[model samples]
Target: MRTHDWFSRKKDCDDKGDPEAVFNVLDSMLKDSLERLKNMRESIPLENVGFDSCTLEAVNSRHATLFGCLCSEGKWKTALWLRRKLIQKGAVLDVFAHNLLLNGLCKIRDMERPDCLIREMLEMGPPPNLVTYNTFIKAHCLKNNVDKALYLFSTMATDGIRPNRVTCNTLVHALCKKGLVDDAKKLLCETLSDDKEKTNSDLITSTILMDCYFRSGDTVQALGFWDQMLHKNIQIDLVAYNVLIHGLCLGQHINVAYGNFAEILKRGFIPDCFTFNTLISALCKEGKVEEACHIHDVMLKMGVAPDKISYKMIIQGLCFRGDLVKAIEFLNCLLEKSLMPEPLIWNLIIDGYGRCGDLGNALSVNNHMLSLGVAPNVFTFNALILAQIKGGNNVRAYSLKKEMLLNGLFPDLVTYNMLISAACISGHIAFALDLYDEMLRKGIEPDIITYTELIRGYCMRGNVKEAEKLSTKMRRSGSQIDHVPCKILIKKYCHLGEHDMAFHLYQNWLMREK
Candidate 1:
């Protein structure tokens, strides 16, 4: 509804005897007004924008609920305004209302206001409770301010509010993320020791430590944690199994990881996309594309739908094996499934065909990609350019460079290097020099490949003096003078019967090596 219509409807709300109904209308009106004001980019006070004396008077007793409604909807600014208005009228907000406001503020990382509110709660009647401390602790942990979170944790005990599993879990996850796994372990141990039911280390905490150890490459320690969970009779969940599978895969324990996958199915725990993708990625990396494809087929047969990752991994596996025919089949399958493949997926096939010297299929894929509305990116153009260069079609390669510019994509270092190399090979020394000047203008630094290409181009034109000067410039620019350009110059010097100059060049290279 329009903002003005809300104001008009607010007038009819008083005739409704239900105070709850009147407050609901007021909440809806305020929400719509806030949205309108946001879209208009207006900075007017929310009170003036929506609420007025009549509306406030009508819902005076329902201030706390209204405040909660606003905060819950993430309209914190409007909520804060209503809160201040309520406070100005001497309304006593209870601990629940205060906690709601604290939650809202903490979610937005508005630390300053929450600090003041916590102080007010401490000094006033409704002291902060466990929920209040947890909210602040969680907020600090999310910001990676573990020190502050710990301080709040210590104060919780002084306030006679014990830190529960949620509090400890937050800190534990934060510590693990910061790579302070040892500290995390110590904290978990201390918290568990303090618990009267010392055996109550839940699956979440155990899985977190296991995942941490796995990521840190301490497979032994990670497995120890897993064994500990099993010993404690903890009901292992799907997330914990996925972590083990991923960690095992990372550690190259693919056999054991697959063993666990089988165990997951045997235990009636259905594997999800992550489970299949992890195995597929591992098998593909190990050059077991067939095994990975088998896993993909098994996923389909089991009625577990493969996601984008599933399709990408399988297609990438096929492409890496140079199985372009199977890769295209999978691509068509992806299209039939109505899953729009990303540009990376298309680039993989294009690059695969390019590597096999099949420029025809590569260009066909590029055209098909464009028709499907997936605009070619830099990598897309690079693959095609490299293919053109490899096929000895320098003109087509340079044309692709121009196409890249028209598509709003700047030619990157690889693009320039390939084009420069191709120009030198085709004896287009002047054109190669022009490309070098363009590189300098575009601020693309010339690396070893670039300088080598340009030096070779000058040597091809028999401009040995210019080639020598470029060699000096290349060294000054910090590109290591590789043997390719040096040998080129030496050959040119010998061809001109300048044996003395060639010997001098060799002597200087030897001296620089020293």
Candidate 2:
């Protein structure tokens, strides 16, 4: 049978009071609707494809289930259509269904609709429950709107719904994220005092608090929390151990962190990506790239797949230590593993080669990136332009700027500064001035560097008056005249045998300093 005919026959069977037939129809329709929703390139009017009143009434009892399924799949518009249809049919969803919808909305960061829905639930029947409140609290907390989350937490008490462990943990995490560790600790202590039994079972909350204290540089308190967890016979997990390891690394105690890593292995707990990443990052920062590389090899040998962050940290370490050859090897290894490193990673290699005056490799890497379909960003272009300028190829650097515009990327402050400085150095003062004018037209405000370059350009061409006027404008624009430009003007005056004018300029500088 054709697909539409099959659906129609199932609907006819449903109408004949065959309950099993009705469920089969629902299952088929749900699958079709979800597929259509997934395939839509852009949202269209829901009325065109959504169930009408007649069709909604056909699957009367399963409406909430259907709505929940739609919400779970993140088809918000379709879910909204179903919700409106159910309300128009005077079908009231239970608190559970309402909570599911609210959760879905929160996940999409649709704060406005969720607020309205919660208000409707509060004013009408099927009032919000613990899950409903927790969903909102967690959503708000995730957005860093901790003030709003705290308001919701207090409102829950007024609604006679006691906050549970999930609620407490969410709030504690948010507070700690905002650097309010003391506030988080206070809240955790109050909650523990209220429910003594919770203190023993709440490993997550304790771990968060310990991590918070460690981040805030309170190693004593962090260790105290760890000792308390052990004394209370709380089961330590891999996450807690990772936190302790991370804290020790943060405290510059790499030896202690490694000791804990060995302990973790002895205890039969596998160190995951995070555990390895933390140690690698710390060792890289400490200029121990060899040690970090060994750990990377060890993790791979142990069949623990390194993530992008793992590769990124190790690559960055190699690049920072000027080991471009090793960095490129890692980049190729990342590609061999079918993991596409982001353009920033590619940029790092380009920049490393550029820093070593290897413009050939820099351009080659850039071409390779394009061949792999990764468009170079402004930073990539800036690094290339700098390399060209350093190679005394000013024309090529200017041509790159034109290429940037063709690629729909406008010249930023750094781009303008580099080109302008290059132009001034090559005695193209007229072109440098034109670029300065272009910068102003493009609304790119000139900083002290821009003015300094322009002033030096003028002084080099023996246009002392123009340089002095530009210096006055620079001060008026709130940029302090640094020693470079000031000395340039004074030397220019002295060179032209204008001793009085040079003395006057020096006296003015002293007055400003005073």
Candidate 3:
């Protein structure tokens, strides 16, 4: 923390009658290290650092704000160190600074320390301000300690500080999030009556109530509040409309969502990205691809440019319809908009074709993904590997698994599982065993499907002994021998006319289930 040269430079610049140069020198010195920053704060006279009111406030405000953020992030030690440095610098304690410290302590849930700070604020020096109380109230509310928040709110008036809109809104949001919509509504009504300005009519509180009601599956009360807002002539913003639209869409009231959308437009409030995206995504989910496409066209007609997500939603819809060609066309439009293709979109297209039994088109889409310069990640390879295996080309699937490793991507457990199942299917029981060992060596734990595949392979080859051994191993591995595999074994025993063994297996499995 030696500052010999920096102090000399500061004095030299100050003597040269360039105050700005002196400030610059101090700034550079303090920026070097937090320790140095603390040292400078203590050693340098504020008057020498161009001690105009603004400059002094700026320096103190920066320190307090930075420490507050650190506290919020739970960096308790750093925040404490900064506070100690400020105290050592003989900095005057202001309400804002105290609030910052209290805010941080509250964020870390340091219950005792916050009470101590509150005591210090009230008894020692600078008293707690409205911001101070609000911070504590917000912290308590966030932790679902609404009773404590309510206590603080009640105490605010005794201290001659009226709760503002922010305080009320914080409580309202917290109550709604906790699904206490009735309490939130009651609070909002009380706040509106007390304010007399009706300032809470901007639809934010109503939106929260509406969302809470929708989430609780009380759509009747949600719509009633909407009507109440309309009757009261509360100005509806696009955000309010979006909330209503999204809620209706989620409730599967598609026609109602559409009506809200049309009403929004009729009121001359143009639909934003959220409005269009919600309708499009909901319609797509309901297998109404044509209607989603029509909405996209409407967006274009209204000069509301669709974003990357909007296009992705439509592409997903088209893929669901097995219209890969149209999906790719929409993808190209997305690229034209300067949005880079994501692996998720590519995987969706691959899976869509794969599920349709169109392996050729799926591979073509994968190659197109490469041409677009987006390297296939694990998900990409996973989808393609599954597709290749489903097409009865286990050899190609195996090669792709190797290529995945060569491209610096480790094959995941799914890749190994698919390979094992593929080998078992082709009657290469020994190879499947070797693959299972390799998976174990790589720390890939076998799931029920892996054991079932091997067990099925053994039973198919009439090696019931090895099949039972693997089943025992699978059960020991903490997974139950699933019904399908158990049924296979019982049938094999019955075919061999071993009715006693078949009954034993069924009884044991039923006992374990119970």
Candidate 4:
């Protein structure tokens, strides 16, 4: 129903009254839309009444008398400058010349190539009128240049040009977007005072101003604007409500956001995919997994099929909660419904599996990630290394580590820690020490966990002298030694009847606790 009103005006001459005139009007309308064509689907009729040459001849003409015809034909906004440029190249001008050029250049907003021509027009003796200024203001507003626009607007009355409703809306939106809330409110008040029908009469522009306030994280001001718009009985679009909901959700003001949505529904603004996703993501961010899941169910009950992103959010929420079984089930269900998970989804599962110490499952998930054509990232490799090392798959873990190095994912301290833990557990204390040294050489200092594992490995090997030396070095380096490793050294020395060394170990543990 919201089509271009292309078939109205000058339709007074019916088919029988003037067949040629009716055809002319119909032909002109479809030849163009408002501005630049997004796509040229059947841009022109292939069959042109057997006059293809005549149709081709209508391409670009610079005569000002052709303004009415040009405006009636293809979009003139972007074409305005080009036409004016041709006119400056010694083309003749006519009465409708300024109107055609104005509509082409400013009306539809093809400012991309209007710079030089616009300057030339400004320098010309023929001054622009109110409509021209309004068009220019709208262009500036659209481009978010409120300052220049405001300067131009303040001088409008000096040029015998009065700002209209559209002009007021543009100024308000530009000011609001530029963080000039008080200025926008003042302008809004002025417009409302001067023009009784200005506030609510143009819902589209008012809604746009409301959105500017909404996106600024000014909920109170945004709602205030919304209430004002409503008092004027302005129509609210679904996207407008969705935008407010997005701000509310982002700000974690969910209760009020929900209230807005309820009112939106009452006002006939239907919720859509974007609406659901924003709310679900917000809840998930707050770690409210239950609320997120409930929302997902609500989406389905409303007969709206959850999109891949919706399922992804739920899976990530479950994964964060360590509910792997449910996450896996949900993943399987997603696949059952033919939803191929994106790379992000794969990363979530890999991270989940790694955190749960299920290296085998983690690797499986990673393999599936690769199979889905998702290239592994640094975080993916980090998770994979942690899982492999913790699961005792040292050989595969090392192999993967080598591959990770080859793929440019240099092992950081955490990666080295996981691999070193595996090495220490396998009685490869020398290898663990080598890794620790390499980590230090790479400027990756080992953490408390790393040194503890190394000390424990040394203690287990009856290398009490080496363990004591390492512990003293760790303490000097500001790394705290733990009790379990101390217990290991003490128990080993006690079992061997080395009472002095055992007593020394006990003394070290007692000192560490302090």
The full ranking of all candidates by TM-score, starting with the best, is 1, 2, 3, 4
Sort order, lDDT high to low = 2, 1, 3, 4
Pairwise TM-score winner, candidates 1 and 3: 1
- Per-residue lDDT for 411-493 in model 3, tens only? 88888888888898889999899999998999988888888888888988889989999899888879755698898899999
Lowest-sum lDDT 10-residue window in model 3: 1-10
Instruction: Assess each prediction's global lDDT (C-alpha) against the native.
Output: 0.86, 0.88, 0.83, 0.73
lDDT of 1 by residue, 387-428 (tens): 898888899999999988898999998998989988988999
lDDT of 3: 0.83
**Cα lDDT tens digits for candidate 2, 1-514:** 3644555676435433655765798899999999987657234433445668776445544765776788889997888778877666456566877787888899998699989889989997578899999999999998899999999998997999988888889999999988898898888777655655565447888899899999989999999989988898887899999999999999999999999999999989989999999999999999999999999999999789999999999999999999999999999999999999999999998988877878899999999999999988899999899888888899999999999999999889999999999999899999999999999999999998999899889988999999999999898989766777788899999999999999999999889889
Model 2: clashing residue pairs? none
> What is the clash count for each candidate, in the order shown?
0, 0, 0, 2
Greater TM-score among 3 and 4 belongs to: 3
CA deviation > 4 Å runs, candidate 2:
1-64, 80-93, 194-201, 458-469, 486-514
Q: Quantify how close model 4 is to the true structure by its C-alpha RMSD in Å.
A: 16.0
User: TM-score of model 3 relative to the true fold?
Assistant: 0.72
lDDT tens digits by residue: candidate 4, 1-514: 1122333423663323544665786677767653335334234333332545554344323355456566666656435654555455434333235545655555445665443444555576246666667767777777777776887788788777777777887787778777787787788667555656654545656576667776777777767766776686766678768877887786789988888878877887668888889889988899998898888888888777889989999999999899888888878878888888876777788888887788878878888778877788767887887777667678877787788878877887777888888888899998998898898898997877887788778867778788777777877897655676667667878878999979976876787678
